[model samples]
Target: METRQCGPIGRPRGFDADEALERALLVFWEHGYEGASLSSLTTAMGISTTSMYAAFGNKEQLFRKALERYTEGPGAHLAEALREPTALAVATAILTGTVRSTTRPAHPHGCMGVQGALVASDSGREVRDLLVAWRDNSYSCVHERFRRAVDDGDLPQEADPGLLARYVTTLAFGIAVQAASGVGRDELQEMADAALRNWPLT
Candidate 1:
């Protein structure tokens, strides 16, 4: 009888790639990129280091995919906010969304993209830069949205879209930091409401 060769061993039983990525995302959200060690990630993903490597390439690549998932999942508010009928509404949605997302009861208490790479070591420099670029892209999108608002006469001719976008994003990032510091959602929402009472800040 000819000996039959066994096929390559498959992923460990009960492996769910999406669920694994979600778990990894939570780990990174709580621990940041550099702080999330390979051991921790694999453990959270419920897989061996070898399995992690085969599925996600490496730690850095896993982080990239986690960030992408975060953008589409928890960080989707920005895209949705941009579609509001007016710039003020868009800003409101953005701030409200930031407050809610950063303070969710069962999730990490901060924005992953904000806290993911605030300060990375030499090995984490690429991730740090990646976050910077990610944040800049968000700013650009808001700036362009506000510019369109100006063109549509939704904002005053003197309204500076760049400045407005900066103001909003800065506030949103600040809210994330505050949430991470244990600030309550109600208080943040109140503050956000107060801040936007006079929209298109001069």
Candidate 2:
């Protein structure tokens, strides 16, 4: 006897994964990782818990994917900023980009990577650690770029790449926090500009 071929699996995932992921990213952006409940996430994604799990594994896994989307979307400026011709330009671009990304109208305020996991409970430890690594990787990239600037004489011989990187990253983070706290984009941009006025801080 010959067996009949089955059409496929369950319901055809009646939603757009890309669009759903974007919705999830906004929820995570608006609320910290721990703060975004399954209900909220699924509601925002316009899916059920079963659909979320079936499509993205679990909450943490969904969060991981959302973070990836954040990096590629709003957080893409860091990579582009690193390509600026001079160290000062790099610093400027990073800060400017941070301010803009964290304060866009019709979008969640603040950096997701910064606000997503600032504090975590016992169960959220893994997510907290993941964000730490995300931030550390960003710092490392900036440090390396600044180091190259020092070697190229773009920065003075006395300039310290590590210190400079820390300074810029710190300002970037500060801008994010301020943006989250209702700080205006213009004011933050002015502050960022002043902070870089005396660049290559000896």
Candidate 3:
């Protein structure tokens, strides 16, 4: 019996894993999971098939890593926004931060998590679920923050925290799509500011 070879061919010639992942993330962000091929990923990452396999295991694993990078980088502001003392401040921060992140000129125009898989396919269920889970977790943070705000008199007692959370998150997802559609950062920021003006008062 003979042992079979697995993954790609040879060892990684040379490439910065972070940089490569960033490139791959952009490809995925722009084209989505199903649209992005291994060839596109390798070309953008400046690495060979074998190198990507050696470093990131497989396409799915590589996408997971890229998602991690996205959350830690562009999406990191959500953590701070959720910790805001007032619900109004929390909503403002989330919307404004979303505008900034989605419109960053250096990277792809939208958020990797939100815009990456808007139209999920049957085979991409796992990755799609992961994105949804991340979005839901972020929403929960907003809900918790608003609940605390209501208890502390920052938000009206009758206001629904879940609704508030969903509203702002919906705005965020919309902003991502608009940014990806070529909306300017200033335009998006203005839209975000207008949305915050609709924030419920105590």
lDDT of each: 0.94, 0.95, 0.87
Q: Write the per-residue lDDT of candidate 2 for residues 25-51, one digit (tens) a residue.
A: 999999989999999999999999998
Better of 1 and 3 by TM-score: 1
Pairs that collide in candidate 3 are none
- Model 1 lDDT tens row, 36-106: 99999899999899878888899999999999999999999999999998999999999999999999999
Q: Can you write out model 3's per-residue Cα lDDT over 1-202, one digit (the tens) per residue?
A: 9999888786745778888999998899888887899999999999899889988999999989988888888788898888877889889999989999898887788888887776688988888888888888888989889989989998888999999898999999899889989999999898889877767833
Candidate 2 global TM-score: 0.94
Query: What TM-score does each of the candidates earn?
Result: 0.93, 0.94, 0.88
In model 1, where do residues sit more than 4 Å from their true spots? 1-14
Clashing pairs in 2: none
Q: Which candidate order results from sorting by lDDT in descending order?
A: 2, 1, 3
The TM-score ranking, best first, is 2, 1, 3
Q: How accurate is candidate 3 locally (lDDT)?
A: 0.87
